[model samples]
Target chain A: MTATATNKQVILKDYVSGFPKESDFDFTTTTVELKVPEGSNSVLVKNLYLSCDPYMRTRMGKPKPSTALAQAYALGQPIYGYGVSRVIESGHPDYKKGDLLWGIVGWEEYSVITPTPDVHFKIQHTHVPLSYYTGLLGMPGMTAYAGFYEICSPKEGETVYVSAASGAVGQLVGQFAKMMGCYVVGSAGSKEKVDLLKTKFGFDDAFNYKEEPDLSAALKRCFPKGVDIYFENVGGKMLDAVLLNMNVHGRIAVCGMISQYNLENQEGVHNLSNIIYKRIRIQGFAVFDFYDKYSKFLEFVLPQIKEGKIKYVEDVADGLEKGPEALVGLFHGKNVGKQVVVIARE
Target chain B: MTATATNKQVILKDYVSGFPKESDFDFTTTTVELKVPEGSNSVLVKNLYLSCDPYMRTRMGKPKPSTALAQAYALGQPIYGYGVSRVIESGHPDYKKGDLLWGIVGWEEYSVITPTPDVHFKIQHTHVPLSYYTGLLGMPGMTAYAGFYEICSPKEGETVYVSAASGAVGQLVGQFAKMMGCYVVGSAGSKEKVDLLKTKFGFDDAFNYKEEPDLSAALKRCFPKGVDIYFENVGGKMLDAVLLNMNVHGRIAVCGMISQYNLENQEGVHNLSNIIYKRIRIQGFAVFDFYDKYSKFLEFVLPQIKEGKIKYVEDVADGLEKGPEALVGLFHGKNVGKQVVVIARE
Candidate 1:
């Protein structure tokens, strides 16, 4: 006879439309064997923390061809996302009991996963907060690393403008630009986030996008010399404005368009003709494409974290029951920084 | 003593709005000395053939910061464009009397221009039709070479799509992709142009965009594997449609936006989010940036022309008096190929 334990999970009620609310998710409890099945490569894990990301919103929409990158969440099932978990039992050769790892796992108290390359990254440095694995050490961290260094091809003294600059990925991009000796400005939805960008993220300048009447005018005021690189996060009107302000031979690394994910119809961008006039290059990328460099990313970032040269902030929700509200709050800009749902501390 | 000649010219009436018409341009006759000024570096030339291109539309607009690349055409002055000319007098060291060249010159019978490195190129291969310089060997040819080869980065067996397929630049782009062993498709405004693309230009398939109700569906039908490269000549709705049908890691080279250049307000492009999902790279370039590679371009194309492997077509307007109607006809899709105003044969 094998040992068994109760598993609590946050389940999706149905395919979501428009802005997702807490009502779109439900809770369920089930019993599972604490041990991995005989002769299986699966590892049974106890979920510690779950990441609340803007990309998760794309997964909530009804199944469609465009959202093929991230598959639609299955109805009446535990929604899966990047999470930090501890292996309770394992039949996989790479993982043993008590091994820490972060990757895609269900929104639950316990999960059974088959470890695969990129699907799961084994944690080596436990000296830092394990919760950081859900964000600054996980997918969002790699996104900032690859999107900024690889895609943006940043150079010293160049002007970098990041929209959604106080969020998980944006905050880190701003810091990285600062580290590279770039002149960085960020835009956030709230005054508090704007302050955090300047004070915490070390941005040269920060603006509350919600307070600005005209985005183009705001950009013109901030970047009088014109923008050399744009880290595009919030699309729609912001992208249109940034296009007008981009310098000749400028580059735009498109990571996310959070502003348009919830809308039934995405907004139309009018100033794309500037792409021609300014001889701009716009490239889109997904973090998964750069996961192979996770080890190199950790090498670059972990040192800064330990030296206190880099700072990170988390708006964490306690317990699995709070996961629904935490994830939904991301769309409303209710979370101040990297939003995480804490399931269990150890 | 210098000889004088009657210089018949076409002058812009004023900054244009909406669609430009023949009435927007007025005729002027001025007597000019057929010689470069003493102690001046300028070269005097008799304009033989003036090339009518879509980009000239931007110059006709009211002077603004955005149109800084090509300065607005001076109001009530003879408009300038790429033209084939015979030098009658030269004070510059590089050019001499009786030399043929292709570069920017006024839409007049005679022009005195100070030729710069990129502004003028001395013609060497005159075995082909001299008119070819106005279209195939001139600025439009260089635009196609740089935009397709450097920007698109095409690989063999990729599916390529070109808009405005029978025009000067687009025609060359389609043929270049075919030469690279790629499957090429093109879209034009009329059946005649479509037939020319499939038969004359060797495109795998061709479509008349004006007849297609759903542009995306039409693309899906033409490219069952999705478009790997998009030569963006006409912007607005076509760009939005191309975004939906782009393959993963596809590339788009934005050469021109003839469809939107005449509009007071450019049409907003939706579906830009596809850039992220598809990991697409959209790059805009000006041929002026690639002028240094003109010799390599000539080396590549001259042999093809000599071997009868290249073909070029021109819709020649008879005289300087017909320049206004010929240039304006491009907006109405009335010209079948490269439009040229022939002021003189020799």
Candidate 2:
């Protein structure tokens, strides 16, 4: 790269409060050289697929003193997330030109990555859909695996509950629990998602939490004996209800709390006393910390995928301009399955 | 064995709301056969000491329609807790007449117990004060050991924070953390408790949270870098503040939430998102669950006690009549250390 060139990007227009609107993000095109600068240990990569996640909503807001995990996206910088890409040019010794990798990349068509070795992982298995690297083979996949196996420590014949059931991580978690001989139940926002949980993902039971006025009662009806583990994705009233229906020594693996992320004030869980009395273990985990186990996760999940033991669905929005809307769609449960933005097919 | 004479005891008067009063528990006398009925595998024991724990306050209230864990206390029954006793008569094969043991007995003078061998452990170490069976040598001891070692998974030089610092389990936890070369700080309700934490228990630093209006500031002042392990006994606002000051990968062993027990409605923790940000592990544990590790615990703690490396404090009230007051005082933060009611010295 001769001079620093600007890249076309989707910039966060303003901080979001409750539900993110289309006006919150702006897509503008600018020219940039798709190559690494001289004497720099960096690589220029064209973005292939961008992962749309609910956690990205937290980054769209102004940085509050109390906000945990991620910083707010700057007013005009490109919104970022996990993306699958190809290295077009390389300045680092380990990475070479035309190496495929998946890690943190920008929302634009091309990103100049400073090749942080710890953050990026080189792609080994290319047989699976490259978009699978955006989800089932990537962050969401590891999240479901580690959050279930390590945090939940699920036992066979135990009753398992997954909220946001048809979403990326929730769908996989429900499947994983079922494979372990658990009685899996999931709650989604719509009839379609609920039906998908039972028919597509093999959940023992599925319910539309939106239609159920009494969530706790619905949980009781589904799990007469009480739930042994809860995969908490959508926090708030659902969390409060699940707490009431959890069996003694129940484990809650908190992967994401999408319901509370966008709210001005987070909902209070009234039945937290259950945690003490029933000896329930509620643990929060990040997939980044579980990167060490990624290879092991791949070893386990890859074979399952090859044999059709595991299946995945993607809701892909084409073009960089649609990236902002696709990312925002996650907060409102707009995506049918794994919401991914396809910047390029190859 | 013969029919037992009438025994006087304190029974829960009614379901409690807000702060408990002495009048909530009525002192009454009731008749019962001390001997185990023919062919019944049960033991009758005279309660020697009664333990007053903060958790009992939750049990005294009206049961919420939520979790089975929050079962309401039955009216007119003697309040129950861990009590050290001598076996007066036995039908159980494992326990003989005059055998000393510690387990769930009753608030009254004598109890006919259906011995659950797994729960009731034999008092092997008679060298220590038998009343220590009510606390440091009993449930509280196992709680501190298991919560610190198993839940916290502490390392040397790690920063540890204990809430309710001078109470039964908190005192031992602080000492255990200290013994492991952890930088230990604790929070209590009173100046006396703060002093006890520093002088008697050897806490690295101590603060009276009641006096400190800004808990986050206090935590920041004490732990500039942030706390690695937080032993949570008190919940509500304290928990909210601690969340802000927790270091990444922090482990929180939730033993009790005494602050929320008496509140008619539970307080919402505002900073729960910090758990995700910090990748904190918050696990709720019951001492009863860790009974299997008691033998191992005794093996570790007994040596330390014998070598004068470990010390303990007890706040004992004489006579069974004061049991109600002793138990109620826990909520008010009146007890200096392990609060025990001694029915008789000999």
Best by TM-score: 1
| Docking model 2 quality class | medium
Task: For residue B80, give model 2's deviation from the true position in Å.
Answer: 2.4
What's the lDDT for candidate 1? 0.93
User: What are the runs in model 1 whose C-alpha is more than 4 Å off?
Assistant: none
**Local accuracy of candidate 1 as per-residue lDDT tens digits, A8-97:** 999999888889999999999999888888899999999999999998888888888865477889999999999999999999999999
Q: Give the fraction of true interface contacts kept by model 1.
A: 0.69
lDDT of 2 by residue, B280-345 (tens): 888888887788988999999888989888879899999999998888899999999999999866
Question: For every model shown, what is its TM-score relative to the native structure?
Answer: 0.99, 0.94
Which candidate has the top score in lDDT? Answer: 1
In angstroms, how far off is B71's CA in candidate 2? 5.3
* DockQ of each model vs. true complex: 0.76, 0.57
Most DockQ-accurate candidate: 1
Candidate 2 regions exceeding 4 Å error are A1-6, A64-68, B1-6, B31-40, B63-72
TM-score of chain B of each: 0.99, 0.97
**Over the stretch B1-346, how does candidate 1's per-residue lDDT look in tens digits?**
7789999989999898999999999999999998788899999999999999998998998887855466899988999999999999999998999999999999999999999889999998888888888888889999999999999999999999999999999899999999999999999999999999989989999999999999999999999889999999999999999999999999999999999998998899989988988899999899999999999999999999888788777888999999999999999989998999899986
